[model samples]
Target: MQNDFWQKMWASGVVGFHQPEVNAYLKAHWHKLLTTDHKAMAGEVLVPLSGKSLDMLWLKEQGHDILAVELSLKALEEFIEENHLHRRFSIQDLVHERFCGYELEAMRLFCGDFFHLTREDCQDVVAVYDRAALVALPPEMRADYAKHLLEILPPDTPMLLIALDYDQSLRNGPPFAVSEQEIHTLYGEHYQIEKVQEDKFERKGVETVESTYLLNFREN
Candidate 1:
């Protein structure tokens, strides 16, 4: 999907992919990959390509500061507005619009392009939760995304990445199809990659064929 296509989707309120509830895969599997007897996340989490999902609320309840990066102000607006949140707005260098205290304990939201968020913007992230980031971009931009993420997050940070794969000819995508090889190619330099889960799914509502992958990118 191109920039104009996504910009139009936001402009026209066409975010059908935005789920109202926390992702079940995230709920069930995220902690498994993030925390074990050996190690656990120590500080705030960075959620890239986050579009005001209820996952932020859930994460906050677990005592994690939610640092979310989003592209559309409309998506952020819908997230807070639809939740009937009394959000306080402000402008910061990275935050185009911010919804203060939405989930308690500084759920800082940056409503702008993820690429524009600098390394300084992600200073305290001990964990990176990518429920929706990599596969959201076109094939060419994947490397840049991985590089920027590793540059920002502290080394040895645990990362939970959820990706979708399938034949693109089967459907048009905003949730673009990305394969396991591509995942390794983009992120292998800075992270030890592993495939934690996979599933075949029917996209009955949307015109798409999809399979999901749960990936662990242990920062090297």
Candidate 2:
């Protein structure tokens, strides 16, 4: 894994990818995967590769338990401190020696590698909110990540996976290009897949790198 890229991104505070507002797509479309037969359903959700973002709070507000996994301890610490949350947990003794969960208690953020944390650790996730998990990794790692998640998920669990589809050469990525076929290739065998959303994007700001693609998966 290219650990340096993410470590440097956090170290340098280059968090342009961290959206301040709750993701609209997440708000609107996450339920589609959670509901049974399109009827509104409520259950715990897992956010793999979650950074210090407010989306977990938003999920809690909607009455669902949220489990977010991240690799950076610094990012997780800042998230709890900035929110002024007053809860803390110790998992290092039980798991990663220093990895912990929520400081306020609504969510759990594992401050360690996602690969190291088993899917059994996130067992309650009836639905997965993969807003940025797959796209964050390089190609080789993405395949393993997807398979590992699917294997650990409860049978028949559904997932909402978001992937970017655009020319990789057009823009280098951490928001990497994960084409529709790749999503299918990675997850289609174990889940019922569909296109939940797709949008087109043209490059915008000078520093703003860009690409476009969207896909969701429902485990059968």
Candidate 3:
């Protein structure tokens, strides 16, 4: 998706994609991505294309550090303002021309293009929680998004991914439909994919299927 499209969405306040609460799928199935002993995982959890989702705060409350990236500064600012987080967070330099970083006690938010992030920038990320990123992209961009993730993340990094599937002919999408086969085709070569759950629901009278996946790096 183009940066301007997202900027316009924020500018116009047409952000239906913004969930009012932390996603239920994240709440219900996040434990599956944890270790057997049930301890909180080490390192920061990366949230790509993060758009001021409350899930980051929820993840921090669970004793995980968060590293989130978004393209819109307006959205990030709204996050801090809406959550009353401005008092606790500080602005910082990302050492990049196009990116700005904000840091709280346990979370970092970068306002910039996610694709501009380098592997070194993500060296501390241990896992991923992708509730919105993958499904937001068009088909042509999805491959690039997945490829970029593989390039930047450490080997064997586990991800909790939530995707939506629906008949595209029925509706135009920013929350695009991504099927099971496409998920496999994108990540099957490198990640051990597990279908954790599937739910069917109606959105705007259109039947939608939402899927959750636990993805761990394939063993060498």
RMSD of each: 4.0, 3.8, 1.9
User: Candidate 1 versus the native: TM-score?
Assistant: 0.82
Which is the winner by lDDT between candidate 2 and candidate 3?
3
Query: Over the full model, what C-alpha lDDT does candidate 3 score relative to the true structure?
Result: 0.87
Backbone Cα, N, C clashes tallied per candidate: 0, 2, 0
Which candidate tops lDDT? 3
Sorted by TM-score, highest first, which candidate order results?
3, 2, 1
Question: What lDDT tens digits, residue by residue, belong to model 2 across residues 146-197?
Answer: 8788777766667766666767776787788787788779877766776756
Residue pairs whose backbone atoms clash in candidate 2: 87-103, 92-97
After superposition of all CA atoms, the RMSD between model 3 and the true structure is 1.9
Tens-place lDDT digits, model 1, residues 30-104: 676566413354467888878868887777767787788777767776777776555543323332333222233
- Clashing pairs in model 1, backbone N/Cα/C closer than 3 A: none
Q: Give per-residue lDDT, candidate 1, residue 98.
A: 30
Candidate 1: stretches off by over 4 Å: 37-42, 87-104, 204-220
lDDT of 3 by residue, 14-96 (tens): 99999999999899888778762233465689999999899999998888898999988888889888998867666454555
The prediction achieving the highest TM-score against the true structure is: 3
Better of 2 and 3 by TM-score: 3
